[model samples]
Target: MDSGIITILLPLALAIIMVGLGLELTPRDFSRVGKHPKAVLIALFCQLVLLVGIAFVICKVLALPPLLAVGLMLLAASPGGSTANLFSYLFKGDIALNISLTAINSVIAAFTLPLIVNFSIQYFMNDGQQISLQFSKILQVFSIIIVPVCMGMLIRHFAPHLTEKLNKPLRIFAVLFLILIIVGAIIKESHQIMSYITQVGLATVIFCICSLMIGYFVPRLLGINSAQARACAFEIGIHNSTLAMTIALTVMANSAVAMPAAIYSIFMYVFAAIFGTLLNRFSRDDVSSRTTSPT
Candidate 1:
């Protein structure tokens, strides 16, 4: 909540988290996108374009307050993270596809996120607040995201033994840091927490559901297999709340702008689990139907 924390510790924390993300990644992750072109392209479209559009529609339809609207847009712009891969593994999704999507999305988001957030700020908050993501700030966003990731990749490339040893610990640390940021955001807006949730809860919930459905069904409609469809569902559904919140608190210097992400963080896992379970149920039924068919 303090300026010191926002300016100093927030970037440091985000850098550590991004580095942890990188430690799990390698060039193979990026190159794998080429192997699953349909799945990857569909997932990216859902993430970078469709999701942002959905958020904008929700913001307009719900008539969200300026700061909160911008926050929702920020959340929409954030890409999936490691947690998506975990969900994919648990729910019969294509974990490899999830990883490739995440790896590529993270790189693309370093550019797209700034564009979306700046547009949100100008459109949503222009009447009163004057927030601008100028070239310098965009460069800062790029550095904050890409630099640490590159550093971590280099570390893993040069020191395989050390990278292996530190991988789990770094992930643990990143999760802990996310929890702290969410809690801090809640505390900073303690009195307004309930009201904020009341304002944004339904919008986020609908957005999450739509995200999962779009991620899954769109790919399936395009003839992507079930496993890859599942991967797309989770990849598009579970956003990197930590990245969104970090950019809000540090880059935008507004905790109000972090509210949607913090609240969405609480709800996304629950929603994703339910969605995954339902998908598995239908998948089992489909398999049984096929197995029971006449030979």
Candidate 2:
């Protein structure tokens, strides 16, 4: 595959996903904060603080290559975008809240992602390898995260019906892009994935579980409702590994660096969905059950 394909595919995929995200939301979607501030903050806290800490530990424990390690860190910072909304709908969560979180996370990540990713590169860069940090990487994030999202928002603002019509097909395209990336990664790194499967797979699974835990429990502890807690759980567990892998393979052009994210992209969905289903099962409507949430 051409580096150009990866370059174009990476940003175009993100923009499509972001636009899909915006199409689902309205201005009133963001108004949930004044109505429900604590829940939102708790969810954001899980995303910003706990997920990053969890990824840092995973990278350190596994002693993954520095590029791969930073790639994991990038995953931590990148939260639910297009995927979260679908999961929210599937799991009967509050979709409006999920969209709001997605929109907000995308905006915050514009700055936060660059900082975390650049630092992770420095922190985890292996001794033998030399990688350059470029300002264009920041621009890439903006192009992917900001530009299409704004376009979608504008469409929503003016022509909501068109936005609605485009929504389904765009989502389908996002899924196809993800599948292609996953397949490409697998084909390119077959032996590397097989050799490092135990280490990286364990890290991905553990991190996914940890994210689900922190996402759900943290919000409940903050006195959020079970539905809101459910939203956070899915959002936290589901990372934007596509962005991380893009940074690794397309921008950084490091196959080893891209592996963690590529592997994580596979693992998180399985583990997170099961975790969400389990949460759906065990959770009770009783206020007491969720209010305490077993710490």
Say which candidate scores most in lDDT: 1
> Model 1: per-residue lDDT, tens digit, 1-295?
8889989998998998888888878899899888899789888988888889999999999999999999999999998967898899999999988888888988899899988988888899865365667788889889988999888889889999999998888889878998999999999999999999999999889898998999999999999999999999999999999988988888788899899999999889999999999998988899999999999
Per-candidate Cα RMSD to the true structure, in Å, reads: 1.3, 3.7
Question: What is the clash tally of candidate 2?
Answer: 1
lDDT of 2 at 38: 78
Determine which window of 10 residues in candidate 2 has minimal summed lDDT. Answer: 125-134
Instruction: Please write out the lDDT profile of model 2 over residues 1-295, one tens digit for every residue.
Output: 5677777766677667777777776667677667777777888888888888888988888786666676678778776756876777778777767877877787788888878777787777764256655798678766777777778888999997898789889888877877788778777777777875765778877887898888888888778887888888887778877767776776677766677778888877787778777776775545467797877
True-vs-predicted CA distance for residue 196, candidate 2, Å: 3.4
Reference-based lDDT, each prediction: 0.90, 0.76
Q: What TM-score quantifies how close candidate 2 is to the native fold? A: 0.90
